[model samples]
Each structure stands twice: as structure tokens, then as C-alpha cells.
Target: MTTELRNQEITIQPEDSEVVLSVERISKKFCRNLRRSLLYGVQDIATELSGGKRTSAKLRSQEFWALKDVSFQLRRGEAVGLVGSNGAGKSTLLRIISGLINPDTGSVKIRGRLAPLIALGAGFNPILTGRENIYANMSILGLSTKEIKAKFEEVVDFAEIWEAIDAPVQNYSSGMAARLGFACAVHTEPDIFLIDEVLSVGDVKFKMKCHRRLAKLRENGTAFVLVSHNSHSILNICNTAIYLAKGQLITVGETEAVVRKYEEDLCLSGMEKATGPLILPKKSPDESFGLDITLVCFKDAQGNILETPMSGEPANLCVECFAHKYIDNANLGVVVKSLSGENDRVLYFTSASDNEFLKISPGNTELQIQMPYCCLIPGAYTAKIYIKSGVCSFDVVESFRFTVQADKTISRCLFYQPRTWKVISK
Candidate 1:
């Protein structure tokens, strides 16, 4: 597949077969104010009718671009994951592809039948029963009456709403509606599926079932574009990923790399929020009588600096400081505190005094702490560094924050311990 954006054209030539979807230089704009938005809509329609092209580059009052020059391609049997923070254009792009909305510029060409689970029960009739709604939704998705009948029981069984299949859908719970909608979409057997975070609405067991069904569909050569915040699901289901930030495409490549980039962005964003406008102290003559903690950072065993560390991984904490004058009996202490509602819990603590006292000169210094395995459970942690000169507090800084991401397969607690189990009696 080849995608070219410079010429405002995207072409996908499948090496072995046919191109399933091609998105050209797509762009979308929106207005912030409701009145201006309605006026802009009327003007856009009028301009289109008059055969006058309105450039998206020109932003009128209250207007902003939601997507700019976005382009990609998907071939037969390929799955691409769309990942981004909120308002990053993931949903807008999906809606554009699903034909629920139109882009202000560029074009989209999709081959074969398309089924979009962009919104849960987006097309369902409240007055209709689940079984009746199934027929309506599948028909809208390009399925014939006979085809819907053929897949009727399969959809109902997969949804696990047999008791409520004949009941009015408006009376069903959100999960039930989501399941029924998802079951209908997937059972229609479309050539391409555009899903936007719908898998997260169902129960865990049903979600697993959906994953299994998607895997089966993939094996049968159905292409998919999935928008989800769940990294594990994206990494497991897609070979390619697209990362978007602030309505712009940041990167598009292998799933692992893209997901890592997206996560790194999240970590940096959180750190920015924590450290905004806080200036670090520098070495100066006036501060000669005391110690000053300047910077603190964490790194993994592989020597990559981490803004976000994974739970149960080895990490190294490095603290940089400056001593303005010579001091005797100086001790440096480091504390890791977990933050929760109206409370702080000390997860780890250490002091240079516990090992050996330090004699400092008028210069910069660095301290390194190694954790063979950082078993602290996944949560936000703040690192506090302080200096004490013979029981007198010299200096302290307590504003560094880092997050530990939990492993999806594991049950997390305050900490993790390695253990072994065996059927000794057997």
C-alpha cells in the first residue's frame, strides 16, 4: 500500500491483491460557537450548491480545524489502530470514513461493504424490539433480508440477550444495547469494519467474546480500523497504528512503536502538568550555607529515561543536587509517596545516613538509587528529596510526579512479590 500526501492523493496498491480503503488528504473544520456553527453550516451548503470551493485553510470566526491533511490506506485483511487523546480527531475520522459526516477537503474511497460501530446503537429504533432492530440495522449496513435472516440466530446468541431479544430495545440497558448492536454489525460480515471504542462498553466476558469474533473475522480476510485507548488490544489486534495529537498525525508505523510513542506523549503531558511554571534552583553564592535539590528523574534497566514506568520492572532513580558550601555530617534522603484521595502513603524511603554520611564541598553532586525490581503498584507517585545537616533541615523539594502503568494480565496491589506454586500433594 502506498500513501502520498504532498499531492493530495492517497493510493493503496495491495502487493498481493486489492486495496480495501484509501483515505486521501482529508481535513475537517468545526466552529466553537453554536450560532456561528449553524451559520457556517448554511454557508458551506450554499457554497457547495453554487459550485464555489471554500478552502479549509481559511478559518472564519470561531472556526478551527479538527483534522488537517490526514491520509492513510488499508488493504485486504489488514487492521490499523487509531490512537490519540480526546479531541484528537480519531472519532471524527472514523465518522468521516463511515459516511456519517463529510470532510471539508479531500476524499475517501472504500471498496466493498462497510460496517461502522462508531456509536453504540446509533441506528436503532427505540420503539422496535431487539430482533426487529437487528433487521433494520443490518439492512442499513448493506445486508439483504435473507442474509439477515440467515445470521439472525447467530447474532442473538452472540449478544447473549435471548430473553430480551423480543423486548423493546429502549428498555434494555446500555450494555445490552451495545452487545446487540455490536453483534448485529459483526454478524453482517462486511468487508471492512470501522469501530470506535465500542468494545469497551460491554462486560469483560463479552469483550473477550468480541475479541475472539474479531480474530475469526480477521482470519477470513476482513479488514478493520479500530479506535481504542486500550494499548494491549491495539497491539494484539493490529499490525499498524496511527498516533494523532491535537488533530495532527504524529506517527504511523508498527503497532508497538506507535503505541510506545502515544504512551510517551501521555507521560510527558502529565509531567508537564505537574512541573509547569516551577523553576529549579541553581547554584548561587547566597545559598552557600545550605544544600539544594535541583532535579529528579527515573530510568529503566535498559538506561532509557522513563516518564512512565511499568509495574514490576527494575528502575533507577537519579537525583541531582548542588552544595554551595562545605558541610559536615550531611545526609540526603529520598522518599517515594503514593497519592490518593486526601492521603499520602509512603511506599519507599531511604537516606544516605542509612548507608554512609557525606562530606560536601561547594559544587554540584549526584545521587543514584537502584531498585532491582520496582514492585510498587500502578499509581501516581511523588518523589521527595531532602538534605539534613546534623538534624538541621537544609533543603527539600517534593513536587516530582511519575506514573506506573499496570500490566493488564496481572492483579495489582500495593506491591508485587515473585512466587512459585506447585501441586506438591498430587
Candidate 2:
């Protein structure tokens, strides 16, 4: 593109001397049909050759904006994670930033050298050996023959694919190529690193090594714009995050808050009526079980509905179950699950454990379990209820999710334990 488009030049704040990358009001569109895309490509080429500018502001038929009005700036020593659902244009934004593709409108300004692991194995020729491909990529990165030779052993060691170092790249699996690409990029120590989800390809050990390397680079003030579905990785490596939805910027802030919001949005999106206040509709009962879980919610001691409760604060678990026929005795159990992890079972309690049993009637029965205070840490959780008789499950309710806001007296933690300390030892 033209120098006028350099680094988006939107604000012209060179005196700041910190901002390393800037994307200004950028947008890009793609055509659905391959033939139409190629035709449009040729037409644009012709127009450019004839000194005519194609209007990028408007879209042709079968075209949709892959990214729209996206803008952000990355400073030295900042690692920003991009979290979004599939087809959210995260990869498209990375490509544009890496100069693999250009935006239809606006421009991107990158102040220093960039190393992109956006498309692993993209530059390797089928017939070329991995060794040869590594040399070629380093050469293209402005490393001389001597520098490339010096770093060859280091790259292979980091990639952990030395056994196939001399094998043709065509014989390499996607994971192998990705590991090699990641190894090469990090070893070069570019000023800015554009990482997509290629880190997800390798084994856990290799991924750990990658994270360690990224940590070192971050410590040395190398900026990163990483796109990944793995929030755990993002939380571990990034201090900030950006959330995107339908090619639009949703929120940009501290990594924990942004990731949490994105995840809750995903959970909320799957339910009916994504817009209105969070009230779940009654679901049908299992005909075989002859019971229905009509409503499950949380409330305070005052009986006011609490969408989110405070951590380590008093809360009430309320459930309304409709029993089809009268039953002699039913055992009620509730399972509290932590959503931030892989649906981990945090707590489970049952009325049977307390030597109590419910006599089911042929109508809705309200059950309320009051807790002195929730001891769980601040995070998302779900409560699941099940009604059983002897050993047979009669009713099973889906999880109802809610967040526990951090108590003013406490902070985010793994687990909460009330304790007191003394200065006796000191």
C-alpha cells in the first residue's frame, strides 16, 4: 500500500515513543464465491494499474465484512489476547496486521520488525528439507548466513523435531510444521510477535516451552497480539485482552475481566432470547421420570432474586419441581460446579445426607436450601439438582449458572478459608 496508509497515521502521535503497532478504523470484506473473488481481484489489479482507486467502502454482491472499524494500539511489553467465537474475524485481523493481507479501508502501522506465526508451513516448498526451509525463512527475516548458521541448532532443539530436521517439509505433519515455525519465530526475537492459534497444535510439554519462551520475550519488551480459543493460555501469558463478536470490537481491558465476559456471553448466547433479562423458561419433564424442574434460581435472605451473588456471602438456593404423581420418598441432591475450569465438581450436598427426605406431591414443590455464606471464590458456577428414589434418578435438572462477585473483604483465589494469623513466631 501507500505510505499515506502507513500505520494508519490516524493520530500522528510519534512523540509518544511507546506505541509499537496501531490499527485505525480498519475494515475488510470477502466474497463468498471463489470465482467472484478472483474476478474482483483481477478487476482491482486492473484498476490499480490504470491509476484508479476501487471504492472499498461499498460491498459487492455475495460480499460481507470480515472485520469492521477495528482499531487498537500495542505498546512495548504488552501482550494482548484476542478472544472470540469461531468466525469472529480474529484470524482475519491477525493476517491484516502481519501484512499477509491488506485491509479494504484504513491502514495499519507497525513500527518495528514483526514475526508472524499466522500461517504455519506457508513458506516451505514441498521438495525442500526442513533444514533448507529454516535457512530460507531466517534469511528472509534479515538474518545473514552466519547468523542463520549460528541459530540452526537452537531452533531445532526448541522445536524438538531434530529427528526430522533433514526430512522434506512435505513429509512433516501440521503439528511438526507449527512447532518448527513457532521455534524459528521466537528464536529470531522480533520486536512484535503476531501469534494465532498455531500454539494449540503441539503437545502440552512443547506448549509449555512455548509459553516459557513467550514469557521471556515479554519480559524483554516484545509486544504480542495473540489470538487463541484457550483462555487459560491467555490468562497465563497476557495482561490484557480484546473480545470480538461478528467482526466488531466488543470490549478491550484486563485479561481476566474480558475473558470472563466473553465466556459468559457464550453461555448466554446458547440460551433462548439472548436479549432479555436472565429468566429461564420452564423446560419439559422426562416422561419416563415423571417430574419436571420448572425453575432454579438464587436469592438473598430477603427473597430478592440475585443473578450474581457476593462471594462468601449468604445466599439461598431455590428450586421448584413439578412431580407428576405422588411418591413415598424422594432424595434431593444439589451439585455446585465451577465453570471456569472443565466443569469441576466443587461441592455436593443432599437432603438424604442430612437424614431428610421429601414426600413428593402431584404438583410443584418449592425447595429452599439456605447457606450461612458461600465459601467459594469469585468465579462462574452452576448449580445442578437431581431427585432420586433409592438408587433410581427420577428427575435431573440442567445446570443454572451464576457468577459470585468478589467480596469486598476478599480477592480472587483458588479457595476461600476463614483464618486468623498471629505474630507469635515473628
Candidate 3:
């Protein structure tokens, strides 16, 4: 692979296929202990210099494979999203392709110029101003001096950090540094672009800008290998997805299919780690003079308590609350949470949020809210009962458990309507 990425000597070879970047069974490993890591590095160097190859056939003590036998090919005008939980080697793979790191086995063949956005501003000189660093960074990415100067204003402008351009990079905030780094990488416009969660940092607007710019790059036949925890970003930007788990490829196919498979694994794993019922605890107990939640449950149309509610079907949410005093409208709601635990992931059935005024009089009461469509991806979930007026009138962490049984429709989308999380990772 004869590519022109800075500090990389991968020469492009004629391919029978028109792939832009080909990652063939790439694998990488890291030692947990820093001392062992340094020692092993020296030993490997010495062994190789002695005309002996470094052994990497199996795991060394205190070492683990961050990536193992992963392979993929990116064609021009296509984007592939890398989706996985943390420690899944997404970043490691990007570093390997970018030539920041090398794989233990297999080969990476590139057919054109490439840009790797591993850690934003990683190559920046801290003492230099942002403006100066841009020149240095882009130059290292294969830009000529004249080209850098020509695109100087555009880079700063796109980064939205014109005011900070002359400031020392070390003084810039994390967001600022990330913005400048992303802008520089994108402007390079290489045939293949590798991004590793750098987009997860910036604010929403800047992220939106990044997405739009990435779309433009795609239009120009740039292929992307994007590592993102955000399923929505992946679905929006990539034509396909590769799911990695514990350094192994789980699935690689159409974006939705791959994302759903990843989500299913997350749900199953969260459930395995969860204690019984997965109910969220109420932060505080209900006031004696306020409302009290008696029960919260989901039932099918037949009025039978739903043992396992399937996705994409109608179910009724019943919230039974007892009010101590008369109130014109007491906000009643249920919070849907994954079995994984506290993350404040909630779906509002509140009378206040939905403008359904509930007249609560002192006594036992029950309100059944109709969920015409349950968009929750198949998973074990717990719901919290909440009744609020001025303060949290009544909220209980205690509850029964419900499982949304997986179905073919679980592949609905990254953004299931109402308030939904694609997948909650522990």
C-alpha cells in the first residue's frame, strides 16, 4: 500500500476490486502494565534486530488483545460505522489504519491518501498558537505549504475558532482543540477518512456541522471508517456498520442490521449484570401530605398484565397514585429505564408533559395511560412511578419488571420516537 499519509510508508497495490481502504484480519494487543509494556517493546525491538521475529501468536501475561482478526473493506463513496462498547478496540483499529499503530497480524492496504482522526490535536505542539499548529498538523497530513496557506482562513472559519486561532493551543479548551483538529482533518479531503469518537466531544451544533461536512465528503467519493457510540450518528453517516465486542467482530452489514445486533448484545449484557427487576430507586420518598404511588404496570389491550411486551405493539401503562389532598392537576408519569441501571433514561407519560390534566382527589386512584405503540427495543426494562405537583409529590423507585420481547421490528431505527435510548451501555 503506497499511501501518502504522514509518517506512513503503506504503498498502494493494484486491486482487482475498487476498494479505497482494505483492512485484512488486523489484530492488536496492549499490556495492562506500563512497565511490562516498555520492557516488551525493547525486547521485541532487540529480537527483530537480531533477525528474529517478535512472537505474537498468543497473549502475554498482563497483556490483552485490543483488536483481533478484524477485517473490512471500504469503497469510495461509502461510509462504515464502527459501533461497540468501550474497550472494543474501535480507537485501536483507527490508529492502526492511520499508521499511528501497527497490527500484530494481517495487513492493511490503502489505495489513496488518508486522514486518521484518532485523538484530536494529538500531534499539535502545545506551545504553538492554534494558527501555527494548523500549518504543522496539515503539513504532516500531506498538505503543501502553499495549499495550507490557501486553505488557512477556511480552516479557521469552519472550526469556528477564528478568535482563538492566534492563542496558544495549550490554553485552548478541550472543545476548542477538538474543533480545530476536526476542521483540519476534514479540510485535508483524503480519499479515506478515519474518525474515532472525536465527534463525541463538541457541542450539538458543531457536531451537526461535522455531520454536514462528512456528507459533503461522502458526496465527493470519500470513504469513512467512523467509530462512534452514537447509533444515530452512525445511521445517519454510514451506509454500513461493523460491530466490535471484546476485540472481535460481531457483525458487519447494513447499518440498521448491524446497529440492532450491537444493541441486542448490549441489552442482553445489561440484563445479565442487572439485579432482579431493574427498577430505578426513587431519589426521595413521597411527602406524607402529598400523593403516593400504589402501582405502575403495563398491560396489553386485553387488560391482561403484560408479562413480556413485544416491540412495535400497543400496550397500556397504568399508574395508580393516591393523593392526600385535592389537586386540580397532579403530574403523573412513569420513567422507563434499561435493566442496566441509573442513567435517567425516561419516557414521559406525565399529565404535565402530555398536557393530560389529572384531577387527583384524596383517596385510592388509578390511571391507565395508553401506549399506542411501544417503540422500546427488545430488552428487560423497569419503570418508575412519579406524581409531581409543586415538587416531586410521589415517586417510587420500587416496581415490577417488564421485558420487551425482541422481534423482527426491533430493527425499526436508531431513533425510536418519544424518549428512547438506542442502547444503554454499562
Colliding residue pairs in candidate 2: 7-108, 7-109
lDDT of 2 by residue, 1-426 (tens): 113345433333433468888888889999999999999999999998999999889999999999999988899989899988888899999888777778899877766667888866677786999999999987776578898899999999988888999999999998898888887788888878988887777788888898889889989999999888766667777878999998999999988788778867765666652221234344455455776666777788998877776677788888777777887778889898866545678899998999888887888787788987777765566777888989988767666767666635343345566666778764
Q: Write the per-residue lDDT of candidate 3 for residues 1-426, one digit (tens) a residue.
A: 364443343446638456888888888899999999999999998997899987876888899989999988889889999988888888888888888777788777888788988888888999999999999999999899999999999999998898888999999999999999999999998999888777878899998999899888889999988887766567767899999999999889998778766765665574553222232322223435466665566778887777566677788777666666787877766777654222336455667887787887877777778878887765445676667775745555444456565556444453245445697789
Cα shift from native, residue 363, model 1 (Å): 21
lDDT of 1 by residue, 1-426 (tens): 234333323333433356788888888888899998898889878997999986667878878889988989898899999988889999999988877777878888766778998887979999999989999999998889999999999999999999999999999999999999999999988889999888878889998999899899988989999998766567778989999887898999987668766764664575555422223767566754467777777777776677666666787876667776777677777777654212355565656546767777767876667887777655455667777876688777776766666564332244667566878775
Q: Rank by TM-score, highest first.
A: 2, 3, 1
The candidate that wins on TM-score is 2
Counted clashes in each candidate structure: 0, 2, 7
The TM-scores, one per candidate, come to 0.69, 0.80, 0.79
Which stretches of model 3 miss by more than 4 angstroms?
1-11, 272-297, 304-312, 318-331, 337-346, 351-367, 375-383, 387-395, 398-426
Q: Return whichever of 2 and 3 wins on lDDT.
A: 2
Who wins the lDDT comparison? 2
Global lDDT scores for all candidate models: 0.77, 0.79, 0.77
| Candidate scoring better on TM-score of 2 and 3 | 2
Residue pairs with backbone atoms closer than 3 Å in model 1 (clashes): none
